[model samples]
Target: MSITSFSFPTSIRFGAGARKQVAAHLLEQGLKRPLIVTDRALGALPVLAEFRSHLGGLDVAVFAGVFGNPTCSQVMDGAAAYKAHGADCIIGFGGGAALDVAKVVGVAATHEGDILEYVWDHPQVRAISNPLPYFVALPTTSGTGSEVGRSSVVSENDTHLKRVVFSPKILARMVFADPELTLGLPPAVTAATGMDALTHNVESYLSPAYHPLCDGIALEGTRIAAAALHTAVTEPGNLQARSDMMMASMMGAIAFQKDLGAVHSAAHALGAVCDLHHGLTNALMIDTVMAWNYEAVPAKFDELAHVCKVAGGGAAFVPWLKTLKASVGITGTLASHGVKPEHIPRMVEIAVKDICHQTNPRPCTAADFERLFQAAM
Candidate 1:
């Protein structure tokens, strides 16, 4: 149930006009027809219009039926369109939802049966056709680096639960992380999504893995998020800050391959039940989870404290986090997101099932999830 090998995508282009070169990249991948998967907002925007214009007379199909947190049904629908239209590739052109949907569609279009059947430790089905068409990830808001990463988190509405489909090959044949396109993200979304990136780095850094490379990547990613997240929130037009945040977001995904801890375990569960913003949910429980882990990994926190100028121990970390949270305007409790205490039991059960819990520094049982949920409350 564990992997000792690591592999990443070979094609990723990052810069100012990376997305604008989609046509060229698509051609390079030998994609005759591409399904551009995006959300309603981006699908309706002038950016999409520009893509259409650029792809004039080309065999291009657009499927924008994406929910905030992607569901298996959504991916199924998208897969149908992809099959019907003979899409030779998938262009994930929005935030995590779009990217996640595109990843699932690519898998479902070729694989048989329900998506959840592919969960790790018990992959009901396995193997994908070599050169399984093309998947080009063009991240706009840059929270969940579904671009270069190898897993997709899709919500199963029947259970109000999130499931992970893991594989490095899920990464796009190419990735486009352009900051210019993200200049339009609202301040609130900027704050929430940026915090999501911070959570990824923190969780990955704390994961009890032997990968020094991931550890280094996670720490640097945290530093980048800490330094740039607030500025990106307050000033959307700050290209420099936006660019840094975007890179930080990508770094979070890259690092987390080593491991993730309780924050992710909690947030993944909370996200399904409350349907809260993933990043914001993580932010709500981050400090709390860190405090819980203080005893298990004090040296890790101490290192993070020094990296983030947190100073001292548990006492210093909380206040420093509060200051940063306020700076990004992310200071809200779970109740603010309409969570009810009565729902804690079921929530804990789902959180315990998430694969992210497996890599957590400390084992989190159902009781642990309930306790963490209570703390976030």
Candidate 2:
């Protein structure tokens, strides 16, 4: 067997009022100036104001320029804000896009050249040798679990293709996972992001990687998500349901360290080509890709079905997912979401090139991706 290393080193404070602890945590560490990196829409919300109220003695600046999908420009722009504010720490306080940009803001602030040059695939990837800002994450949404992630996915400005900056150095030093922060999410956003969390667990478990640890975490995460996603969407005020989904989301993020599968490859492709929300793309394509993937890993499917309590085991798992999506208000296909048949070719090309599918239980050829996109449509 080949040598493999594993690490799960994030400090987390999980509860209803966990966001209140961020100020104290930073003060104890002697970080007085914090730049809160968030999306424009979230910045305008009362939740951010409430969070700010907790940081009474600290100097805080908001960088609310992150919007839509995260991009290289956003990371660089955030770095500029960091320097302008003379921020000594970073407070990532939104959904995936904002948190992802926040993760790398320190990299851009302290390093040379474009932030894209630090992506794992860059030919001469820059080293993250400098000490990064003290970073903490408070997730307002449970979908991407960017609060706990070690990598950031940013898109190119012109091409809009996604690029990944993978490194342990950029990982949040701490995570304040407060489910109350998610209580006000719109039903649609909750549903899409919930599905995104579920997809992460499902795809990570299905990946043919050799990490049994991730497999276990993925299975448990699937069970939690299956039980709580609909309630979390329908009754947004139910803190218990929200909390379960949040924990499940973090578990999915942790589990995917084993890597993901073709579903993510397809989702990334859709995000790049169609500019669809990442989670929504995953929700749209999950059943289609899983139906195709079932034959390759029947036992894993059985395990998933068992964890999710599907009556007919592996054969019923895909149907269960379809039902779950419908229950959470994630209806319609790729075409219904404005994807055309003409978009399939470009999405397929991008999917085949995405690294996530390399560990898929079944290998995906360009032809396979073409079929998947066509079927999803």
lDDT of 1 by residue, 1-377 (tens): 11111234436677777766778767765667998888878888887786567665458889998967888888889889889898888888889988888887887888787667765545355555445557888888868876778888888768757777888768777777778888889888998889889889988988888999989988998888888888899988998898889889988998888878878878887788888889888888888887777788777887777777666754577678778888888876787778999878878887787778788888888888888889888
Question: Over the stretch 122-176, how does candidate 2's per-residue lDDT look in tens digits?
Answer: 9999889899999999899989988889999999999999999999999999888
In candidate 2, the residue pairs with backbone N, CA or C atoms under 3 Å apart (3 or more residues apart, or in different chains) clash, namely none
Choose the strongest candidate by TM-score.
2
Which candidate ranks first by lDDT, i.e. highest?
A: 2
In the order shown, what is each candidate's alpha-carbon RMSD? Answer: 4.4, 4.3
**Which residue pairs of candidate 1 clash?**
none
TM-score of every candidate relative to the true structure: 0.93, 0.97
Candidate 1 TM-score, C-alpha based: 0.93
Tell me the whole-model lDDT of each prediction, alpha carbons only: 0.80, 0.92
TM-score of 2: 0.97
